[model samples]
Target: MVSISNSVKTGITTGTLRRVHHIALNVQDMQASRHFYGTILGLHELKGEEVPKTLIELVAAGKVANFVTPDGTVIDLFGEPELAPPDPDPKRGFTRANHLAFDIAPELFEQAVEVLRENQILIDHGPVTRPTGRGIYFYDPDGFMIEIRCDPMD
Candidate 1:
């Protein structure tokens, strides 16, 4: 055989990483989390397969959502049996590095909050106006704060 290393080098080519494939998260209740993400947030559901320990994938806006991002990355929602929300320290207030955010239509801010309140989800803050647009903060069943807003400021 002629120069195996040379042949390998010729075969290799440069490529660029596009974007994220998925995001894995441990949730308290798989069904509830699914409903919240799938129904409320409107993330499209895939096959709904259960693979024991492996993570589940909920495609954001499903296959047709490819046009949403330049790299065509889909958001994947995961469910873990042990992933419960941390206990809150009343004195410290609700604070943590873990959170998810979504941008809402500027005019629909109040409607969004009403929807959350109807679901009995706690409203942590206001859909009040900031310099950018209206924003509101709330917690999921797992105590993970979810921010819904329009025109978020840098």
Candidate 2:
């Protein structure tokens, strides 16, 4: 058997890396992606000059779109021509669990669902139950799978 250690002797301490600081994604359109994540998803968009200093280089001097979740998770969307589009087949849907999951407050779950409906966004899988919580799945305009999980199911 093999064992791994991080007690400083093996190099990095447990605090070496904190929680996920950000997630970068490639998208089809800057404006649409910004609208979806900023407006529909209700994340705060970091408009010009408001983008974080540390992210400037990677953000490509206003070329990328930046949004922040209420919990401070940063989302960076890069608008580039697609190398390939999301699979259009049901059998390839799960595709080995390729998806991004976001958390929503249980109290606001119904409102969120309503918002999705109002926007005419299709719900691919849920509002389904699990021992852990209730979740809804869908796809972003670029075909990335997205999951919204509302815990403490009533």
Which 10-residue window in model 2 sums to the lowest lDDT? Answer: 88-97
TM-score of each: 0.61, 0.79
Candidate 1 lDDT by residue in tens digits, 1-154: 5555644545434565455565455565666776777667665554434221233323322211111112333444455666534555322234445466777666677788888888887777786787878788887656777788897444
lDDT digits (tens) for residues 24-105 of candidate 2? 8877777777888988898898865978887777567546889988888888898785535566553256344588888988
Clashes (N, CA, C under 3 Å) per candidate: 0, 0
User: Where in model 1 is the C-alpha error above 4 Å?
Assistant: 1-20, 48-73, 88-98, 152-154
What is the Cα-based lDDT of residue 84 in candidate 2?
A: 50
- Backbone collision tally, model 1: 0
Clashing pairs in 1: none
Any runs in candidate 2 off by more than 4 Å, and if so which?
Answer: 1-11, 54-62, 89-97
lDDT of each: 0.58, 0.78
